[model samples]
Target: MILCCGEALVDMIPVDLPAGGKAYAPHAGGAVFNTAIALGRLGVETGMVSGVSTDTFGRMLASQLEENGVSTAYLARSGRLTTLALVHIENGGATYSFYDENSAGRSLTFADMPALGDEVSALYFGGISLVAEPAADAYASLLAKERANRVVMIDPNIRPGFISAEHTYRDRLDRMIGQSDIIKVSDEDLDWLIEGEETIEIKAAAMRGRGPAIVVVTKGAEGATAFFGDASVGVAAPVTHVVDTVGAGDTFNAGFLAGLNDKGCLSKDALGSVSDDVIHHALSLGATVAAVTVSRAGANPPWASEINR
Candidate 1:
């Protein structure tokens, strides 16, 4: 079983008018939530640990997760407003301007972390959950408790502009990084984490020394690369007639975790010694899922059959 712990929110995507303008269309989103839903849709055992809201939008988000087969036994609904991301789509890609701060997700506490049964193999986390206060501290604590049994994966999915430049968000993030076993970072995410530092080897080595045994750097269009210990493997992105890249990376994480679980190698140390064939299989799965996601309008990923094909 894989447990995803983070925010479950709504993305208000822009729909272009025939007259050449835009409007907001609400869709369920949040990096960890998307990954959990995708994994559940693929027939994998999955659960989500996060806070929801009592509002209608939050209800819709929770319903979507349940419909996709994600277990929400650990979900907490509060009176606070649900987080929102006003996503803008243009030129076949989407960019987000978030409206998150003191939202329900940010109000989480360490007591909210669900007990991972012996069946739970990995813990996945990402997005702005690492940026807020009580929730950030709470998630970091979750990583500590799960460090011995389950693999911990983190995708920063950084929103630099949303965070205060004055505060040391980076330093706080580094603590979580040190607790993770795997870290998936996009080119844009890396740039946001540390400007002008594009050296994969250097970044991977530095991050590995901190904690993560494996580091994956995703390059849009160009594909992605994975670093395990001192070795690295690169995989080119699969061809696709692009639509929108709303949940591509999140789905990619789901695919990778799915592949790892299928191989009976869900532990952090095991991932570092994966063979070339296994790495190729994992990367292919990730690319396939990402391709399916990019073809959709919002954060919706294709069914398992589409990924298999």
Candidate 2:
């Protein structure tokens, strides 16, 4: 089983105002949660570990997870209010304004961590969970403890607005990047984090030096590039009329993880030598899953049958 650890929150998306009043629609989101569901839907044995409120929204999120075949046994319920992200769409693309500080999901700590055994083959974590306090420390500790146990994949999924530039997050992020066996980043994230970095190879080389055995940088619409030690490969993203890119990248991680696990390349050393054919196959699966996600609204993805895998 692949374990995804992080936030599970509600994304309230804006809709056109009616009579000078704005309206919003609630959707289940949070990068880790979305990836967990997409992985489960792809027939990957997956589970989620995080905090959720006992409130209505939390119940709905849990239901959504179970419905999609993701186990929520490790989900902790609290009386605190569920975290919310206000999603704004412009020109057919989406951006999010978070409301997670001190929210229920942010309250998760090391005490709440579940015992991960040999049943778990890989561990996935990222997003704002790496920025906050006791939770952040706890997650970092968990990653450190598991570094020698399984395939560790990290996707920063950075949102500048949600993080404090003065809080030493960069140092922490750099350390986490080193601890990760696989690291995925977006073009925007790279620009924000790397500063004026041009070539994917340059960025990947810099990131690989930090620790990740394999580094993947995604270019929305254009495609993605991958790096493993001295080797590199680039694959063009599949074309599709994107509906909303909410869970596209998260599902891309899920698909790539699933494909790697299926191909028995979950180890850092194994991924470091992945062939171009394997890389493209993995990217195709990732893009396919993400394509299905973008075709629909929210973080929902295609079921296993739809892909006929």
Candidate 3:
């Protein structure tokens, strides 16, 4: 099973009302949550670890996960209010205004973390949970505990606005990256991490040197590339009508991991020795999944049947 650890929250998406004004519609979201849902929908054995409220919105989030076949056994239940992200769409792009203060997802501590069993093969980590206070520290601690036992995949999915302190968040993220087997980052994230001191490729190489056997750089619309050692392979994005790119990156992460898992290349040794063909296949799967997500209204990912078709 692949375990995803991070925040689970509700997104208040802007929607047109029947009357005249627009209102926010609640949708189950959060980077890690979306990835877990996508992985489950793709027929991957998946589970989630996070603090979820007993509130209505939290129930909605839990129901979405269960409906998609994601295990909820690791969810830490709490009476704290659910985190909410108000999404504003302009020109097909979405921006968020978060209300996460003292929310359930952000309230998790080291004590709230669960013990992992042998059934878990790979662990996925990223999103705002990497930056959020107590939860961030909790996740970092969990990563340290489990890094030696499982294959680790991380995507920073950086949101500059959410970061309270640049130095601290960077230090924490750098430490997590060192413990990861595979790391995925967007072009924007790369630029920010490396501060444009050198070329993107050079920066990626530096990141690979840190620890990750495979480093993937995603260029939205253009394509994505995976780097291992001195070899790299790039795959073009699949063609699809644009609706919204809410969950495209998260879905891509799930697809990439799912493909690797299917090929039995999810371990440190296997990933380190992975071939160009295998890398290409994973990137293709990721692009395919992202295409389905971008063609949807929200963060809705396709099921296994859709992918098989």
Using TM-score as the measure, the top candidate is 3
lDDT of 1 by residue, 81-177 (tens): 9999888777987777878777889899998666767877889989888878788888888888787778898998887766774256787778888
Model 1 lDDT on a 0 to 1 scale: 0.83
TM-score of 3: 0.98
Report residue 117 deviation for candidate 2 (angstroms): 2.0
TM-score of each: 0.93, 0.94, 0.98
* Model 1 spans with C-alpha error above 4 angstroms: 17-21, 165-167, 195-198
lDDT of 2 by residue, 1-309 (tens): 899989899999877686886799998889999999989999999999888999999999999999999998878788888889899887768788888777778988888888887788788998888888767777888888888878899998998877775357887778778888889999888777787747767877887888888888899888888888577777787778778888899999998888787787877667767777777677778888888889888788888888844
List the RMSD of every prediction in angstroms: 1.9, 1.7, 1.0
lDDT of 2: 0.84
Q: Estimate every model's Cα lDDT from 0 to 1.
A: 0.83, 0.84, 0.93
Q: What is the overall TM-score of model 1 with all chains considered together?
A: 0.93
Which residue pairs collide, candidate 1?
Answer: none
Worst 10 residues of 3 by lDDT: 192-201
Strongest candidate by lDDT: 3
Model 2 — which ten-residue stretch has the worst lDDT? 159-168
RMSD of 3: 1.0
Judge candidate 3 against the unseen true structure and give its global Cα lDDT, from 0 to 1. Answer: 0.93
